[model samples]
Target: MEKSIHKDQVERFGSILLEIGSLLMSYGANSMRIRVTLNRIAKAFGYNLELLITHRALMLHIDDKDDQHSFNQLKRTSPHGVNFRLVSGISNMSWRIVSEKWSLDEIEKEIERLKSLPHYPRIIILLLVSLADLSFCRLFGGGMIEMSIAFGATFVGLFVRQEAVKKTFNPYICIFFASLASSLISGLAVKFNLGDHPEYAFATSVLYLIPGVPLVNSFSDIIDGNIMNGIVRGMHGMVIVLSIALGLALSLLIYQI
Candidate 1:
């Protein structure tokens, strides 16, 4: 009886480890970090896991290579039914992937799967709140209206199309809206002669949309030995910055004519 119970516990522990690993994968964590997190999770489950994570997928290493085959089989048996104890783990992974330059289709599929998990609504709310904060920071030079609009638009966007936003939304779109909104508002302010330095207000408002912080963070991440993560983040930041500049320049020229 004891032996049977021990075996059951081991199997449960293994399943939990896989679930944790999957959640970490969705967050944009590097393989090493994922493995470390898995180790901690395994410890929580009262088992010791030997795991490996690559950019492509995850692997479990057991004393016998054949044992890994059993683990893989177990994972395949119920890929969708695994109980995810911590929903934030999955959302973190989703955010990580979405921030990277991975194929949009793949990312969309992953997010779709993620949404099927429990607590998905809460995750979506968190994402929208972050986006709203980002938008407000980029609009109206930190005034009450900017804050109100950011909160309102963010809530509306999230509440209206939670699933669609999760499956099809792009962070860049949020940035674009924030920038464009600020510009239009500034233009109106200028028209009304509400302020003499409309250009400065508009420019300052959109400064938050600049990719400088991400770029710096990426560089720091790399310097700290997270090469893959650093490179991905840095590239994303650079692309966003360039795109924003190009967009603003084009808009200004078109408006001038």
Candidate 2:
């Protein structure tokens, strides 16, 4: 009966650890950070954890110090996205679990709450992203006309992306469409010679589609010796860039530029 109880406890820990690891993976946490966070939580529970992180899945092996209880699990992560809020929330929760010696139930509740946290409204995001792109236009030596074109193009493109995401389209497909939409709008400046730097407007309009998070995380993973995960992330970022290029190429073809 004691052994049964021990096994059950270990299994529960395994389930929670899988949940935590998968959440971190999906939200753009690097492998090192995820492994460290899991280790911290396991140490607080009087167990040790070994985690294997890949681009699409996580493998976990956890065993209590006594060696009497052990659990192994493999859980596939969801599609990756950038959510620094959730990543930081999970990191902080791990520290709390360690310092406060939180029970499994408490940790689980906190994870649920973090997952429920709402993002900024869509309209706010669209406006801010458009404004940022417009600023980039000016920073790149564009005049007011170029900035205006970039702003309008970015707004429309981002709106298309948001709507595509809502309908659950493939992420790369969404990016392609967004880029195409933005380029088509900004290309007008070049076609009509509306600005002194119409090329700057055309170029900066799709800058918002750059996969900055994945590219940064890829380098971090590589520097931390997670070569496989790093390569996969790097390839993923490159694919996104390729999608952007294809969209831009189609726009050039259409405008015969």
Candidate 3:
């Protein structure tokens, strides 16, 4: 009975650790940090977990010689909600893994299973905010005055109508507003000769869209030995930077035309 209880406790702890790790991954955490946090969580629960995180899935290997028994027991005891949440979190982190590593059918099924969870709303909101921020930055050439006003507006939108914005404000609307405001500000600056570098105002405004911070974080994650996560994040940062450059070039071309 004592042995059974110990096993159950370990399995429950493992489930929570995996859930947390998955959440962190979705938030762009490096693998090393994820591993360390998992270990810490395991230690707190008086268990030692041998874990591996790939771009596809997280594998938990128990070190005990009787691990097979523990594994089977865990398989039987694991809550469907916990498993569903873990898979959903992984899928959220990287959609590329869906069809290739974890079956698309299975992920979809799990997503359906876990649709009632509270964290789902938070995850959806975060994704929406990130998309909106990216679109806003892309549309505005980094405009100074307009970007400032938009930032304030966005903050107010987030604060006052947090739930409504979370539900309704998709990426395109944010981009449209940002672009309209930026164009107005840029036109005014150009017309009035308000500052020495009117173009610089636009450039400064769109700085929020720059991927420099993500690039730096990716480099740091790699240097710290989270190579897989570093590579993933670094690629995303590079793409964002390229996108910003492309947008700027197009804006310049349009101005000339």
| lDDT on C-alpha atoms for all candidate structures | 0.50, 0.93, 0.50
Candidate 3 residue-wise lDDT at 164? 35
Tens-place lDDT per residue, model 2, 13-106, is 8999999999999998888899999999998998988888998889999988878888998999988568999999999999999899899889
Q: Give the number of the best model, judged by TM-score.
A: 2
* Worst window of 10 by summed lDDT in candidate 3: 72-81
For residues 1-257, could you state the per-residue lDDT of candidate 1 as single tens digits?
A: 87566555555546555655665554444445565565644444334467644333556743222342233312321112113433454545534543554443454465466656565467675466646554654554555444444444344433433443355556565555555554554444434544344444444444545665457656766776768767866777787776556545544654552
| Best of the candidates, lDDT | 2
Shift of residue 160 alpha carbon in model 3, Å: 16
Give the per-residue lDDT of model 3 (tens digit) for 1-257: 88887666556545555555555555455567677665654444344577766543566754334453343112221111113354445445334332245333453454445444455465465445544643464464544454444344333333333443355654333333343344344444544655455554445433444555457758978898878768976886776656545544555555652
Q: Please give each candidate's TM-score.
A: 0.50, 0.98, 0.53
Off by over 4 Å in 2: none
Q: Which stretches of candidate 1 lie over 4 Å from their true place?
A: 1-15, 25-33, 43-167, 170-174, 190-194, 207-217
What TM-score does structure 3 among the candidates reach? 0.53
Candidate 3 Cα deviation (angstroms), residue 217: 3.0
Error of 2 at 90 (Å): 0.6
